[model samples]
Target: MIRPDHPASFLEEGPFRTEEDQYFWKALVELTAMEETNQGNLAAFVGVSQGYVSKILAGKQVPKARLRRRFAEFFELAYEDMVALGRQHLESMGYPAEGLPGRRCQVREPAYGGAEAAGRPAAGQGEYSALRSMVRDLRAREAREGTYTEIPLREATASMGGGSTETGDRTLSYLSFRTEWIRSKGNPEYMTAIRAFGDSMEPTIADGSVVLIDEGRRQFVKNKVYYLRYNGQMYIKRLVDAGGRLGIASDSDNNLLLVSDADDFEIIGRCIWTARELD
Candidate 1:
């Protein structure tokens, strides 16, 4: 671990109080060092002079907010993830939890392939990862802050029968939709795309159907289908009022499962649209 060798602090006085300020900067500097490389490469990655990288490593400088985003890219992490990590580190170092990140964010370990696994140094994984993140963030940011609207096509499948265990939640890609069209359904921010498995909802929602879900619509609406989790299993089924109880049903088979208060049920979203491959 590269210890802070210089006396300069990384942040200006503001959000953090005096007592907590020291640990905040200390945590950030140490976290940044975990991704540090040779001086020249580090400077190039951050688009800064070698001297700036040196000063930063020595804890004598703080990157601006935009540059922090670059650091996030370099570290192959979201900016919010970095902040959450720094908060966790600070708490571990005996700093108070108040005024830090309100929620915990999990930092996933990066998977390395052949070369690194064979005891060789990484071949520009940092640069490549940073570039990918930059492009992905740019596209998502454009959709969020500009006129465009893009819904994420998640890499997941919801079963129509017994229930499918969700494999992953990564965004495989995005599906562009008209801003006006999305608004007519629900909030654009809550929209996502996932595939449905099994023929249980066939004739209504077929097997291999790409379903558009509005995750914000968690309220129970009678006769509406939903992507939900029941007892730790994922499903796409119509929700109905079962006389003060909740009912889950498959369309094609007309199978119904009533939920009691003791059952664990969570509504992920309301299905608003669907598409299936012709073949």
Candidate 2:
């Protein structure tokens, strides 16, 4: 850690009462020393001028509110530390410390990989293991409960193209509707809600609408709306068999899309249902 060579009393002054100011000064000095570079190098790293760095270090200039947060983030200082340091500096200079950010701690639930390996040793697995564990636990819990938790059958059914299935030995067919609900039991497949942003699929699926997609469904069907992954972004389009090769088309227009290689594109999921808000 690069300690400021100046006395702490020097920082006690006007405009440094906020915690953000303390974090900014500390982060700036630390970052400058960590790189073993002068004000010029520090300025370039933070997208500022060398004079700006010097002015800040000398307490001759006060950074704006926006840049204070950015500086704290760049230096990886804790929120409380940033605020506390600012208060100390401001108080020393006879300035009133106002609206300092309170200390906050965040707790995150641990993720699991599978049932058989529940809470087992898995290093470097991170989110992957946690997801697997959650799925396994959910399935086991649902099976023990012995009930099909009701989901939005309308939305779910619409997304899956309204296929009816007989539940076990029951004579009556249980109707499922596609909705935005998921069962709390079973080995349920992962689904994601994505907001449409472009006018590529206008009219049928307008921009700013939300679509529910099942990531597990990679199979393509002719003339059905599906989420297609190409390049790095995902697009929703209808897949059609043009002659002997696969061709994609937009629903708003009848124009056929140009295809170079089928391997480059991947079918992410069939569009189950879309939710749009009226203006």
Candidate 3:
């Protein structure tokens, strides 16, 4: 039995005893969410019923050796990681790690350009031109230093519920900030303005507030509010680093949301300032 003071012992009292176990489960959820695929598709790919996949995601049922390999293949992850996890589980019980599945082929890289491989539009294609124009416009405006700096207002909204998909290629408009005021924080070119929705981050960040994000500051600062994306979901919250495990917390919610390695987590920028209507 693990001690109560152990930090990484999340769900220690549950069916998940080891980090590898939780990683396997989270990897499934994160990959499925990233791919925008449902459990039904995963079931079809893994030769299992949708109910079984649900059980796996819920940590109610552990996948067998064959099913584990199938999951690795479907997610394009290394099967050896799953095999190593199983070996660790067996070895923890004072049992031999022998007779488990061996290593398989490595994951192959996409044979295309970086942007296309990432499913994003390449240069001069799709909405790429619009995005480039926005960048150029921002650069040109920043070059003409004056009393105020022009900050591009993003067309999308950052919701506290972790779901905001209205990302536009071009900026809706620009909000002028005092040149001295904006310069104190960082370069004006790296600053952006975006509307924030949801009340989970109330008091500190009211609903419908226009939040200023310092895109140049991507470094992780504990307890600071940030605009981030995890598992393909956007969020505006304070990040708490509990040892190695990242915890996403909200001003309105007391519970901390644990972020695992499998989560496609990226800190878009740190929230520096906010302007909201007086209610």
Candidate 4:
């Protein structure tokens, strides 16, 4: 088992015993540990399912280089460092890089913004026009820097238990955040905010909280919370697929349902993020 002390300890466990992906696993472990959260949080932060995270950790899968680079930068690795790490991983494994994710590029954080990095230039017509265009584009993007999409907040509440879902067609307003930012955290295009009711989900998803849901993700996945609708009521529950049946579990003791089939139910989405006020 990988521990915090060893950093890349997971590389030595299970299928990772082979050298094919030890280096990549090492880098991944380091990156995931940076946020001080468990594998589940890492999966959420990287916008993937927990099972997918497990595969990567186990050396059963190699993610696209674009994804690897994104997470690398998220963990503050310079593009140069990122590429170096990849090459080092392959070398340590003694594997040919014939088939791999993607080529590495020299990526780095911006030290200084814009043309200033090129040093001061003599005043010229061409330079003047270029400067003008750059400034214009910068201002436009700065105004929209957050890159957010407006997700409608519905008046309907997803009852954990006891409480009934409000079948109203009310969309009070919208919740906005950077499309890329939350997409990096979860599915951006399918994200929406919901109001939680009751306490069945408890500590995981508390009563009267606002939670983010990824409508694009509706598969009944283990260890991930999902929004479900059944029997004229709505709920936020975790699903466990058991052969031909579905096992529903909740953080609170009150709600647990095992069904041979949840065909009568409709899955809304996967719950990606949740926020409950202290009041």
Ranking by lDDT: 3, 1, 4, 2
Provide the global lDDT of candidate 3 against the true structure: 0.68
Error of 1 at 143 (Å): 11
Steric clash pairs (candidate 4): none
lDDT of 2 by residue, 1-279 (tens): 222333343335444554455555543443333333345545666677867766776555677766665555444444344554444433543432333221111111112222224353333335234323433454464444344332222222112111112112222223232222444212134555555555656777777666656666667778888877554445777789888677878766676765567446777677666767789
Q: Rank order by TM-score, top first?
A: 1, 3, 4, 2
Which regions of candidate 1 fall more than 4 Å away from where they truly are? 1-148
Task: Return the number of clashes found in candidate 4.
Answer: 0
Per-residue lDDT of 1-279 in model 4, one digit per residue for the tens? Answer: 112444334345444443335445545643333223366656777788878877775456667756665655555454345445545544554433433322111111111222334243323325344333433454455446446667777776787776466756477888877677676776565767878888888888888899888889888778688888876678888887656577777788845677645345878898888888796
Error of 3 at 102 (Å): 86
Model 1 weakest lDDT span, ten residues long: 102-111
TM-score of each: 0.48, 0.34, 0.47, 0.46
**Model 1 per-residue lDDT at 6:** 29
State each model's CA lDDT, in order.
0.68, 0.50, 0.68, 0.61
Residue 264 in model 1: shift from native, Å?
1.6
> What residue runs in model 3 are displaced by over 4 Å at the alpha carbon?
1-145
Model 2 has an lDDT value of 0.50
